[model samples]
Target: MATSTLSRWFHGNVGMVTSVIAAIAIIAIFQIINPFFLSPQGRVTLVYAMSYFLIVACGLTFVIMIGSFDFSVVSMLKLGAIICALYIDDLGLMVIPLALLACTAMGFINGLLFAKFKVPSFLATLGMSMVIEGIALYLSRGFLHIISNRAFRSIAVTFIAGLPSIFYWALAIWGVCIFIALATPFGRQIYAIGGNPTAASLCGINVVKKRIYVFMLSGFLSGLAGILYMAQFGGGSIEMGADMSIPLFASVIAGGTSLAGGTGGPQRTILGVILITWTQAGMSMNAIGHDIQLVVFALIAIGMSILTANRKTMSIVK
Candidate 1:
């Protein structure tokens, strides 16, 4: 009885437990290597640097939890930034909403292609990525478009309690997501659909509609992240979102959200984001090259995937 009870508890809480331990371990190691790793400035920089990615991961967490993938997250981010830059002069503060609306539209199209046309989520998102990238390149003309709007730039630079304003944005978004995921019927339905779509449909869940909403949310967050990125950097470029897949996916997976779905939430992704951010910060402080950092991220992702692989749900991943 004791063994059985212990086993059940461990299995139920493995993701959270492991992530917590891993995060603590990483922080400890890094702090040892550089005594300043936990200093006030360093902590603020780490959170500020990770704010946008954290926001994106929060949105992606929903999509992943529903047993689907959104490959266009990075592209959507780039598109949003480009759109914001293109119209910032004319729209001023309104540019943010307009850009987000565009991204939401793009996500809706992705969902429509998947849920209505029977296209696989992977392929639908992949194709959308290409479309977004093409649009971004054309609009930017293969050059960086500087953001001249002071009000828009202030969004990224404004600090509250010594942390970037974007950090608060990330926190607020995550809070809402957590509430939705834990306290609402919609959240439960997402897990049900992910765990078994046919069964969820039989139980009267609107699988298709929910899936579309998931993608729309993902797109909205991606767009928000893009705007934040532009504000932080003072410009938008076609390459702004290049090669973001690894870190974003890694953060989700490492945080305990399985690609197989139905197993994680926004809270887990928060831990994952912090871990990845800390690792990257440590590497940068240690003078590690960007290429080597990518390798580190890839390896961490692979290891986490292997650790979290749910053999029983392997068939459901498709």
Candidate 2:
């Protein structure tokens, strides 16, 4: 019976462990290919790349927990950056709060439509995302906004105790989100809604409220990620976060989070983002082109999705 129990535990959690191992392997490979990948400067740079990815993944994890997919996260990220850059000269830190608030409002709108109007989450998010992107372009007039503030700029580029500030932000965000997921009443409600909305509602969970909160969390995180992007780059563009959509989603799934919702945590997603960032940075430093790197990541995401699907089928059969 002990052996049987051990086997069952392994079967259930092997994927999570394997993904961590795979991430470590990728880091090792990067270290081997570019000795700089292990050097202090290189390590900090890698973490810098991982920061925004981690932030976006955190928000996506919550949204996915409610069994809803959000494609507008990238657009929200871009919008936040645009807003921060456009207003920072006049507003300084105030821009940060305003950008986060805007993203939250956008999420609230999406959630309201999804829950009240019965619009499919995917379609609603997609349409909202386009609208956001459009607004970003209009504000920028198809140009980049150059950010000149030294203090805010340091938020991404400065090193704190041998780590990038963005890295610290990523860690803080993950830590806080994990705490909420594990300890908060809202977090419990989100999981319940994700696991089974109908049953959760029957059990007195306010499914609509939970969904709104989840999306709001997603929006806020995306906004913060955009701000980080601007700080890191010293400027922003409507295109700043356009390429992050697939990679952010891929990181969540690769980290063993269920897209069907109610499973996984920010910690797992962080591991996944770190792995992908390491892989991308290592290749780039070694002179590998962006096209090849993206293709490889796409393939990895596909494999993980297949694995997740097969595992679900096996569970049902059992």
Scored by TM-score, the top model is: 1
TM-scores for all candidates: the values are 0.96, 0.94
Q: Rate the local accuracy (lDDT) of all candidates.
A: 0.88, 0.82
Q: Model 2: what TM-score?
A: 0.94
Backbone clashes in model 1: 0
**Residues 49-95, candidate 1, lDDT per residue (tens digit)?**
68999999999999999888999999999999999888899888898
Cα-based lDDT at residue 221, candidate 2? 93
Model 2 scores worst on lDDT over the 10 consecutive residues at 309-318
lDDT of 2: 0.82
User: Which pairs in model 1 have colliding backbones?
Assistant: none
Per-residue lDDT of model 2, residues 90-110, tens digit only:
898889999999998898988
